[model samples]
Target chain A: MNNSEYAITVKDLTKKFGDFTAVDRITFDVRKGEIFGFLGANGAGKTTAMRMLCGLSVPTSGNGRVAGFDIVRQAEMIKRRIGYMSQNFSLYQNLTAEENLRLFGTIYGLSDREIKTRSQRLFQDLDMESMRGKRVGDIPVGWKQKLAFVAATIHLPEIVFLDEPTGGVDPVTRRKFWELIYKATADGMTVFVTTHYLDEAEYCNRVSIMVDGRIEALDSPDNLKKRYDADTMDEVFRMVAKNAKRAE
Target chain B: MAILNALIKKESLHIIRDPRTLLITLLMPLVLLLLFGFAISTEVRNIRICAVVDRHTDETRAILERFRNNEYFDFQGLVASTEQNRMLEEGLTDAILILRTATGNMESQIIVDASNTTMAQAATGYIESMVSGQSGNSPIISSTLYNPQLKSSYNFVPGIMGMIFILICAIMTSVSIVREKETGTLNLLIVSPIRAATIILGKLIPYFILSAVILAIVLMLAYGVLGMPYSPASIVNVVLFSLLYILLSLSIGLLISALVRTQLAALIVSAVAFMLPVVMLSGMIFPIDNLPIVLQWVSAVIPARWYIAAMRKIMVQEIGIGFLVGELTILASTTAVLLTLAIVKFKSAVR
Candidate 1:
């Protein structure tokens, strides 16, 4: 396959801690501009796989490329091209929204003029002009999550990895967050998201369900549901999880 | 360069916005100066004493009168030698001066409470001088060269400088970094394009600048309020030594943050492990030479020991760098070793 066609390509990627393998020879490919949902039970090793692909953790063995850079040898190059938002809200709570944006913008190597204009556009996009000067700790969790997502993609990275981005929030807020993800994909930015919420899995163009450190299913949500003979993505997940060898 | 600038700006904003950190950093030096300067004093003043004369003579009476008139002694009246031990046990008197006439010559004995050895030594010296002065023979002609009055504050000021700088720079920096780790922001920072070394140096720059500011305030109070000697050469020495000490402290903080996983652990370790050693083993309060041989060997490893010694030489004696090369070299090497270790630990931790 042409490397430019895929934002992330992993082959037999594995990570082990002592004798226990956290991720056991998982393989997958994510197309550019695709909103790929990585769904897993709590200990299914989804986050470990994402970490390896983000160049944050080393794979025990196997080959992986992120943004056309080798995950092992070109980790620094990969870091420069991709953005990541962790499961926890990672922005500085003491800093104002504008300050956080300025910090991430500069670290991402954006020029002063670009940071200024892009931040202004971001504030307008989120309808958060009033929050530009507010400390992140003072903001609601929903707003913080949305703001964190925008900050992660502030430099227009080719791929933005969101690890359980909408973990705890109201349904309406989670819907609004998915809208932002859709907007990024529309702008030709790949969205690699991990979520435990089965309902959110339906929003992805393609979904992979990991069980027992292995991908049990990877296809469009419609195809997964039809193949499992299930009515909903939740049923599809349940059908796949029954075969997991590792206990939750 | 841009990444470092952004990090520094963010760190500065954090310091400014956090009232607790700001309050401690600003007020610690002044508070410590007052506590160490006036409260923890070794200088003897108005020591309580009882005079016991078994066979009174004109010379004994004259000596008693002199003791009564002296300002260093608060005469607690005459006591029988049999009652002296009870008076001392009840804390009525700090010492007893006994005079006996024997074969046309008078023999004097002084019994002192030596629980606090430094204060006891000073009191004995004072009594010896007063008694010898009345014997028509001049007392030992001794003069304090640098500090004529022998103020304890002069000795404590440099030590306070060492303590305050290390406490603020090392403890604060480590706590701040570990706080980021606990809150998970450090992971985001590591995932960014900036190098780990850049992140560490960026975090340290603001602290270095803040420490310099604190040093300036402390020196001002030392010279302005406490009457510590100030000269251009002394000021240069202070600035140079303080900068080196700050670097050593920052690197130590970085090493701690790299090793610890939580903010609470960082706070506890920096306080008990780092701050305690500076206070007890740095010769800040107790003299290193007076410490046990084992502790003396341990003290040689503490950067604050060399720092406090160098500061005293510079600020009090107004000495040149020729006298401080050994201390400066030790401090520089400690900084180098800690910094290299911190960088290596941080790199591996990031991975």
Candidate 2:
């Protein structure tokens, strides 16, 4: 229960779809209440690895735990402890925001009063109370992303896994979204996020750069820059990506 | 339990908001029932026939007159000889009846166009009855033929019920599942604590309820509107048969949904792969017994065929429950097997 305890641990985890190895023998750990960024190029297996840790997919081999539950033996427990906002648009497009939130709240098993109260309060907190009646498909993509994030975490899960959550958002909206992430982390929820944006990696407490089904670099943004003798995480990413390709 | 309740609620919202799905769910079955009941009929009626009275005798005219009153044939022209061939050839008439002139010691001969056999047979029989003067009152003979009463609704009611069940249960089940896939909500659910089985159940339960309601509506239409038999045996038989058929269709749909990545693909697969067997070999359009030996076995696996057989027995034959147990067993077992495979395959495929 200590704050410094590991919230997620993966040792030599791997996944293969037929002959294609999506996630190789990658090992990592996420401390409780920390923002852990998973960065990779398209098809670098970042989403695949995140999926395994979230219990959406079973690993071919290795061992892991999420929120102190074994990934192998207690995948359902792991799933219960995590919230996921997938890269693809996830919310029901035809439903109003209030209805969507109520449904997610119901899925989380909250009482009717709890769902009513929480949805009203959350919309107010997000400054989106006026848009609650609008269908999600009618709203801007940026707003939908933010609403999806809120819907994903309505259950107050211990860890929230966001896969490319800010893919198509404006810079200002992305910044606001990061503020939401920070707010959640501050409230003691661990943020396990995947993004292609290196700047987003800088906002994380630590990050792992995956290339070709393996993690080629893992450190804080400052540490990775210093270790690779680069000015920015982007440069460090390119260098590690080059070496990962060369090694393969 | 909470997650399931929430997910189900969310799904209901999607179904309600999507006007296309709402329209399909509420109206499709009833529309199809009405279409099949009132519009489509297999009984050949009002068929046009031309007769040639070569002798112009009173007896021959009496025989020709029978075709006018015959409900089966629409007697068109009573030409002497030249126009007989022209009428049959131009499609103005389905058959030509030629009464040959008699010789001193010869009986009069009736030559009917061999083609268009149903009309030929009806005309020929009417002529013989007139000649024999056998006018004693006898009961209408409904001897062996495909659907003896020529009741289109007798066969169509069951056929439409099967078709409706397939459309609502199979297509609707896959639509819900594929929507989840397309929107990436399925991934979210998979990653959540919800079991794959629970997700499948959630997708199925609504459609099942909807299909049951559809079945009830169709049954009422078959009985009340069409005046098809509505005995307890037929009603119970259709309900039970359609339920099993729904499960089979839905399971196949779920299996296809799991295999294919897109809703379009699921729709195509359901139509091409599932609907064909139900329509062709299920004895809805073509009788299974009349098919080639290999295809007869093929029809054996078609749940629609079994349902149609069970329906015909209950509705037309007025058979008791003992006659239906075999078909019912096949339907039930097939459903169970398909459902088990669907659940097992979906468990991994979604992940």
Candidate 3:
């Protein structure tokens, strides 16, 4: 399995676009099989730092490891073991849900039988069997969100990164979507998700609050709420994010 | 290889589902070829014609002087008869006139490159009228060279091939790639283990195959329905030339995809910035010689100018492959440059 105690580890990871440091020397760790929340206001470098961790972009200066593979030199190996869903809900809308699953699974080098069995298991777990053959564009946005998760995890990747997977999703649907995330982590698959919504941070095993390209606070949601003298994660986030210099 | 197949399969699914890709690649060629073939009949202006005088005299000088001063033609001044084939074949002039007093009387013969049917027709008409309209006119005999049939479709076939190949291959490929960028799927692709070059190849191979089908359909219609002249001996030439031209068009699409981040912008640039010039200035429907000086310079770098011209030699004239050396070199080199630029730009753009 090659599973480490920590699914992701980083030290002083920084990403600069010219003089502007979008992700500035931030450090964090995500334990294996836990729901790790990455929270920030818009344009606070959540996407950039997540991209660096997911092996999508090179860090300007620092270090990162995902699933025991170095982010810089072993990016390809990291990619083979991880799945990603981008901020905009990025499955093929033209393809049927099953077909999208098949496509990603195949890209991860899964056999037809393996893709089919995994797709069946996901559909059953989500109770989305009736909609499996329907085109993703024909489905509702919440369903598309769930289908994207299925596509990302179809190959049984060790870790999955979701950039605002619940953005634009209804509040009730977002809560329901958490059930699937819980089930995934129950199977020992690590999840790293980014969101601007502080309410979602309450559901994480640990949450990091980033403000203006730096992580101001990182801890369990309960610990952050207690430390900030707040009753909710929203207050904790507001306490940290109040001094942000960057605009959305 | 499995990863590539998966990508190709996914890309093919996108191509099949998006009616725009199919509509452009499959139908654009047929419609443009048919519309331009029968519906359009435009008179050429500023026909560049040069003359070869065997022996100079007062009468011949007067005749040459009239053409030189005429507004309807850009006279490429007195060239030797030995330079006759060189001038027309290299596109220095549309046609050449052979004038002589070695036969005792002024016997003038006109030779126009039949590749450009409209310009050839226009140039031959103007020179014949000029000889007859003059005072010391001789026994004038006219002949259009290259191929005898000179079907008007010869003009439209090459022109439509140039316009629609760019429109379909470049526009569709660019829009498809850019659509991924717009939908945010390209970020997902980058996160995958696949290299940028593999992604590009998977995206392009399907279009390249579709381009081959479109080429076959276009050629079949041109040779069979429109009665354009094509010899059996030039089949290999047509195949090789079409393959090279398709590769060039696909690379242009890839470059466009790398430059633009939005699908709408890709479509607009491919259709307007590129295809429009091919139609307006590639000697497709209008004469390049007729364009203003600056536009003439603009048309000079247009690849279709060379593509349509060479297609004429291969499809219409059925000339030897040697005749297309200049056009082949231009297309091949441009393709190489564009492919390199596309790969480099694509890597940076995607990241």
Error of 3 at B207 (Å): 0.6
Q: Write the per-residue lDDT of candidate 2 for residues A1-248, one digit (tens) a residue.
A: 32449899889999999998999999999999999999888888987788788776789999888898888788877777788898854888878888888877776667889888888888999999888999998988878888999999998989999999888777898999999899999989999999978888899999999999999889999999999999988899889897565232
Best by lDDT: 1
lDDT for B187 in candidate 3 is 80
Which candidate number has the best TM-score? 1
Candidate ranking (DockQ, best to worst): 1, 2, 3
Lowest summed lDDT across 10 adjacent residues in model 1 chain B is found at B133-142
Tell me the tens digit of each residue's lDDT in model 1 across A13-129: 999999989899989999999999999998999988988988889999998998998999999999888889988768999999998988999999999999999999999989999
Model 2 chain B scores worst on lDDT over the 10 consecutive residues at: B101-110
* Displacement of the residue B27 alpha carbon in candidate 3, Å: 2.3
Task: Give the range where candidate 2 chain A is weakest over 10 consecutive residues by summed lDDT.
Answer: A239-248
What fraction of the reference interface contacts is present in each model, in order?
Answer: 0.88, 0.83, 0.83
Off-target runs (Cα >4 Å) in candidate 3 are A1-4, B43-138, B147-150, B290-297
Better of 1 and 2 by TM-score: 1
Task: Give the alpha carbon lDDT tens digit for every residue of B136-191 in model 3.
Answer: 44666668776554456777788888877888789878988998889987887888
**How accurate is chain B of model 3, given as a TM-score from 0 to 1?**
0.72
Q: Report per-candidate DockQ.
A: 0.83, 0.68, 0.63
For model 1, fnat equals 0.88
lDDT of 1 by residue, B1-351 (tens): 888988999999999999987997899899989887778778888999998888888999999898888888898888988999999898888999988885579888898999878778999999987777788879467778888988889999999988887788878999999989988889888888889888988899999999999988998889998889889988988898899899899888888998999888988888898889999999988999899999999999999999999999998899899988999899999999998998899788888
Compared with the true structure, what per-residue lDDT tens digits does model 2 show for residues B1-351? 766666666667667677787787778777877777778765556766676655666656776677777787777767768776777676676666666545422144455665767567765675555444433445565366545566777777778777667766777788678877898877777776667878888887767766777777777777889888657865776677777787888898788888888889888888878888888888887777789999999988888887888878877776787988898888889889999889988987976
